[model samples]
Target: MKKLSYLFIALFSLSLMTTSCREQKSTGEKVEEAVEDTGDAIEDAADDVSDEVEDAVDDNK
Candidate 1:
């Protein structure tokens, strides 16, 4: 029947939408974690550079 086809189509669209939404959420989480890792790396590098500068200054004193 025509009504049954419409119902099936609606259900299929809804399922697809839910799957896509879940995928987006997972991707967003991965991106956030990557950004955090990058920030940590940058901070570590900065700390290393600062330590080197301090050592050089101490040597001059």
Candidate 2:
């Protein structure tokens, strides 16, 4: 029983190590995510600027 418990613990630890190692994003994936985030930020900024411009034009009336 004791040997079985040790074997189980070793297998569990090995699995945890392997799964954690693979969970990290590859460099290419990381770069893609960064580009997507930047795109989202730019889009949000454009929307904000557009709203501001509309408000300014309305104020001119």
Predicted structure with the largest lDDT when compared to the true one? 2
Model 2 Cα shift for residue 2 (angstroms): 16
TM-score of each candidate structure, all chains considered together: 0.58, 0.65
Deviation in Å, model 1, residue 7 alpha carbon:
46
Residues 9-57, model 1: lDDT tens digits? 9999999888744334588889999999999999999999999999999
Q: On a 0 to 100 scale, what is the lDDT of residue 29 in model 1?
A: 89
Q: How accurate is candidate 2 locally (lDDT)?
A: 0.95
Candidate 2 stretches greater than 4 Å from native: 1-22
Ten-residue region with minimum lDDT total, candidate 1: 19-28
Per-model CA lDDT versus the true structure: 0.92, 0.95
Reference-based TM-score, model 2? 0.65
Residue pair clashes in candidate 2: none
Candidate 1: C-alpha lDDT: 0.92
